[model samples]
Target: MSAPTIVAADLPAPADPLAQVAIARAAFASGRTRPVAWRLRQLEGITRLVEEREAEIAAALSADLGRSAVEAWLADIASTKGEAEYARKRLRWWMRPRPQPLPLNQLPATAWIKYEPLGTVLIIGPWNYPVYLTLGPLVAAVAAGNAAVIKPSEITPATSALLARLIPEYLDPEAVTVVEGDGAVTQQLLAQGFDHVLFTGGTEIGRKILEGAAPTLTPVTLELGGKSPVVITADADLDIAARRIAWVKLMNSGQTCIAPDYVLVERSVRDAFVSKVVDTIRAFRQEEGTNGLRIVNERQFDRLASYLDATSGEVATGGVVDRDRLTITPAVVVDPDPDEPLMTDEIFGPILPVLTVDSVDDAIAFVNARPKPLAAYYFTKSRAVRKSLLDEISSGGVVVNHVAMHCLVPQLPFGGVGESGTGAYHGKWGFEALSHRKSVLSKPFAPDPQFVYPPYSATALKIMRKLF
Candidate 1:
């Protein structure tokens, strides 16, 4: 079957949120997306979209967030492509239903779970990683054989417009549609009652999404943000840890939800780790030939600048901020007060705070006392320390000896707990999250036991009870 023709001009003004959902739902009802071949075709189309439009995607990202070509490729283009490729390769196994053993009571019965698509779903993307966050969830929706309506972040207008133009050309236009708008538009879409809603954004906005979907009773998967912490033990390789932390933290000017929001190091090695991190940050900036990192907008720039202003701790390096340029040099804060905003709030900028702890236990205790984060990172060589940290703290996911690498792993379920967020989706987890597992049981005609009838004798009742 040929792909449907959908373009910006074909869509209604403001995209008529209800009409978009209706179109996808109608397409889903036709059952064209149910076949494995069609699903694979859609997934491959996404891969083609990335491959053919690499330059356009990179340029859009740069225009929206000032992300360099290399950063754009790694975070938006490559990561999304990897997810599509991974899901496409394993979709067959994921679609196959596994045979399940029956209980003793049902002697001649067979049971298994079949994964079915939720008619039509909505994916609301965030601006920080516009292409990846938007397309990433779409990958899951498509892999699950469901129709999808994608709402790219309005904050990244350039990327959003690009997606609106490109998605229909690449994927099944009727089955998958892109609706571009702001928070009000998102609220309007949520009011239309989708099968499932997956939103990636801040906690406050997540709450609103949940509230908006409440009337429709739509199941929602919120990939919200929080103060994801990094614990550095004495036994960890400080050099490697510093490099990894600095590398991820500086990516996209630290706008990532899973970026190390703050670091807690053992008191003994605190000074050394801080020094290494400073050197690493400096070296990275020098190599990139950029002294200051660009913030997404003036509001975010002011917010990050305020954190620097309020902090009572010593600024180890890179505290300079250019308000007019909307950029702040990567700043490292040492021993910031626990009650201050720098430590309390999720610093979604190019600022790093390194706090000294008495021991690994202290670091774990500190993390446990706060709301659960989206992710928690630990750098330790000792197995005991690693195990202890894993068992003790609660988070969406964990990465040992590195930071933010878990998000790249397609096999792992990525999400948050408590205030961080709810639900998980990546590869099979993503497919499962968007797909419903329907339980099926088959029985032979001979297995219609008379004991199960309403009119039963004492012996029949006794036998039924025993069997049950």
Candidate 2:
């Protein structure tokens, strides 16, 4: 069905950032959002928002980032719908109180943990995949029965504006709010000190969010970006490995936080793998019927173009850029200098660097020396090799024979280690992260014993030591 056009007059004017947060806090205090039925209603509202506004969301994404309709549906719409559906189906199970095993001394008591809301939560989203990142955390917040204030990235104004318009229409306007503005506005919101904050963006910005939340002692979940790496073994399927890597690298023009930043291929298969990767890129580009991939904006385009200009390695394929259109053809750099920007910094673009390593041991050592990535990918047929890599390397998550599939799996926790990110949130993990597990213990007053009281005699003390 054709989606209706979003008119600027129809969208509510950008709310006063502080006032928006205040509204959410007030809504949370009203106790209206805590019931299981209310949580389900909000979850269902999110599903309706996505279902009824698919075309609008796609149009907003295209206006903001030049994203294709199919790409928008896959990355932002379907993924978000999946998260809400999963949470809606499992929230009842997630909310059930878990019984705890009591110690011998507490025999007459029963204990269990009950999940409760964390009050108002603030979700600061990034330009890339703005809707999914913003609403994905909101799913957790609402499922945990907390009011939410969503802060969409200013860089993607079209998507942000659309969200501001749509969220209030579909969700409970009092319980969930969308605040739109630049970083300073974010700072103002942080100062208000929400119960919890989740920010998804670059590492440098993540540090600022941490600092901003520090004064308030507000906990934060930072979904920051880093140089996520991929390792290809000698026995790996080059055909499958190349196709997967190339496909993910081209996603969102490689602006994804979990996109394989660089490749460490075994020396024996380096040349063949590089060849296949180049072929795969060419084939995919032809299939998509695009000469160059669109970058979000000029700053990102300039950063990516500069990396291409400065790289010392051979460009195996695709070194073209169209400045007028703000797009860059995919480029594969082979064995660039390790100290260059292409190797040192997180290349959030359609640039792939394939580095040759002596063995899987060398690949492990190489990844270990760098900051732990948000994800690490390995393509190997050997069980022992996969097990060894799994044991030796530490990342937010790892995928064998694939790339970035972990994010789509609702059962697994998705996050980073060290610099890549701080906390995990997806499915139940997300529900738990956004919840406060309160421990409750019930005991009968009639069971109280005289020896348990303070002023005990020698006989009572002896009995307490044996039977209390």
Candidate 3:
């Protein structure tokens, strides 16, 4: 599908998208970015940018997504800073060649895998957590020693413009360029044949991105979203589960890709858990004055509103919607019809649906019946139950007794599965994702056998087969 055209009026589209790619490509060719020192410097620059410009980034986030300063810092600034710092500390070790064990047939040779840059790459940022998602991949790209072109989403114009302005000032200008435009601009950049492209957005957009990159055969890493289900086992801690679920659900007004899209609670504890979750939402909103969760735009606002309208489920609390402000109050719907849009579609809003299942089997069946989600969250105390869910459910990642904490740790890879996303990137995973692992083998010319090189005589063939 051709992605809908979105022109950013405030931020002018790049005059030449290919030129942006060309500049990065030229920069990559210069070999300046290849050095370990340069990689470390860029990582340091990212850390410094997030540190010194905390207020600016928060302000931009507020203007773009109505995010509070604390939420802004926690979600975008702090997370990104951590990722860059994590990479900076471990990049030299990551870049070192890893020796590969050779088979007995190749005993006289030595082989190793060398990590190298994939030249110029493209990082297409999403609007929700604009700064972090965009720059997080850049962290990986630069750490892998590749020049990159960052395409920040036009949906969040303020943050997009801010990124376009600030990125060059902090990092190497030629090696990294920010192109601000819409889907058309993204398509244009894809056509330029990047060495690799990492896109974070919806699965539909991901398909379009893949299509756009097809002609050039550009390798892509798609961080797309699906309905990540939160399974609450009967043996779980309801209070902690409620708090954790409400916390991530309210973040960025539930626009997060890995936020609990829906809940599947064992019937026995459904009421208690639902009540606690609703209460937690009330308490959280009261504390932060976030009764009305902000939606990015009218399209998203209307989409979320429709889910609330179509749901056959009973509303537990907070069903308020203000079209004027584009805000939908935090809501909990109990047992919506499985076929309903609220249950089926990815609810990228503050309105969460809580469904009750008789047993863990029912919950597993419900989740597995659908496309694999980016994340599957299970709140359980029992090791057996945790193991069951972990083994039976197929998702990109899983969190036990928590929601979305896996994303914060750079040790674990973050990405989606099936419709959710393609590849993962965090600390070392990100480094490896944007890098090429070239196999290097060395052998002495004196030991090279003629049987391995020539038209085979029967005796030579038998010898070659025995010692290939």
Candidate 4:
């Protein structure tokens, strides 16, 4: 199927976006964000605020996405809290300035790298895992000492409302502000010049952000979604892999940007892995409350449904969809053609497609044929196979013998190449994005010796040449 454009009526509002940008720029101009201590204190404040209002955050997420409080806490609130602390604990190290030795000719001078804050960052968030995606980057911006204006996803209104209303009260309203609205607002925000922009959402929207920010030549960090792959090898532990994968996946009814969209299993172990995954999913749903498998909203429900109807592949397990309950049964589609609708787009729902491949090379080729995914996973005990796979395939990040664990690690850089995304985040990369490295050099107090001065006599030229 051809990729289609979404109509204006279908799109949400971007009402009053520029005002937020202006507020943020004015705040940056105030120089309140220039100090490292102020940024660290702000990050700490975010952490304290989340802990104090955990219940409120959970409720907001639950109401918005029909997500359970437990799920909301685990996915959104906890993530934000962790990110805030992560930034806070490391702020000193991240902000420390190094001392450089001066040359013998200029002993009084010194030179060192300084991580200066980028002015007025604009963060455009995604609907899937809205709180984490929005706040995670915000945490990084705070850490780097940049004033940020956050644009939460309009599709998740409760979240957007909560963030916009509460963020200013807890955070430095001058340093951090939330602008709640749709694409129109985002375009308006992009129209205003920002030092940098960080966006997390679909590829189509990411493209619009890029185009909108193009005039100012403002750099952007896009945390867009793609069809991230998970390969289940024949030599893998089916039961262990199934349980862990299902646990991480069924968190938000599989409405995760980095969730394993599809699985590639060797034909020899296909049935066993399929059975394990199905049974595991069943167990997972039984534990969930009535609203566990929420379809987000009507629009997403329709979009997720389209994949099921348009796909030519036979359903391996559940194909059920109930709008009243706002749920789709944990679905597994087997033997799907790579060209089918189910395989075409990033499936950010409970549906899981299984593609059978004969060998690891075939799986690698399959993933490489499409746009570079945000992540890739392989569940195998074999070290050699893991190394070989890692060496062959390129992705934003990887999880060896597991799925989706790489993002949790604070050390590694996370972002996609080509279509998936442009830049990485987490840890130092976040600081790097928000900080500018301005090289500083000092010269000697003495009238500096000039070996190559313009007015050179023959004797002076000879001496200069000898010195050279």
For TM-score, the strongest prediction is 1
* Top-down lDDT ranking: 1, 2, 3, 4
Model 3 agreement with the true structure over 1-468: per-residue lDDT tens digits: 211222234433446877777777888999999999888878888888888899999999999999999998899999999999999889989999999999988878899999999999999999999999998999999999999999999999999999987777678878888998999999988988889999999988999999999999999999999999999989999999999999999899999999999999999999999899999998887865755888999999999999998889999998789999999889999999999998778988998899999999999999999999999999998999889999999999999989999999999999988999999999999999999999999987777668776687999988877876
Model 4: colliding residue pairs: 13-182, 14-184, 14-185
For model 2, residues 154-180, the per-residue Cα lDDT tens digits are 999999999988888778787798888
- RMSD (Å) of each candidate, 1 decimal: 1.9, 3.0, 5.3, 7.3
Cα displacement (angstroms), candidate 3, residue 354, comes to 0.7
Better of 2 and 4 by TM-score: 2
Q: Candidate 4's C-alpha lDDT?
A: 0.81
Model 1 pairs whose backbones collide: 426-430
The global C-alpha lDDT for each of the candidates, from Candidate 1 onward, is: 0.93, 0.91, 0.91, 0.81
Lowest lDDT block of 10, candidate 3: 1-10
lDDT tens readout by residue for model 4, 146-173: 8999989999898889887777766776
Candidate 4 TM-score, true structure as reference: 0.91
Query: Candidate 1: lDDT over CA atoms?
Result: 0.93
Error of 1 at 113 (Å): 0.9
Stretches of candidate 1 off by over 4 Å are: 1-15, 287-290
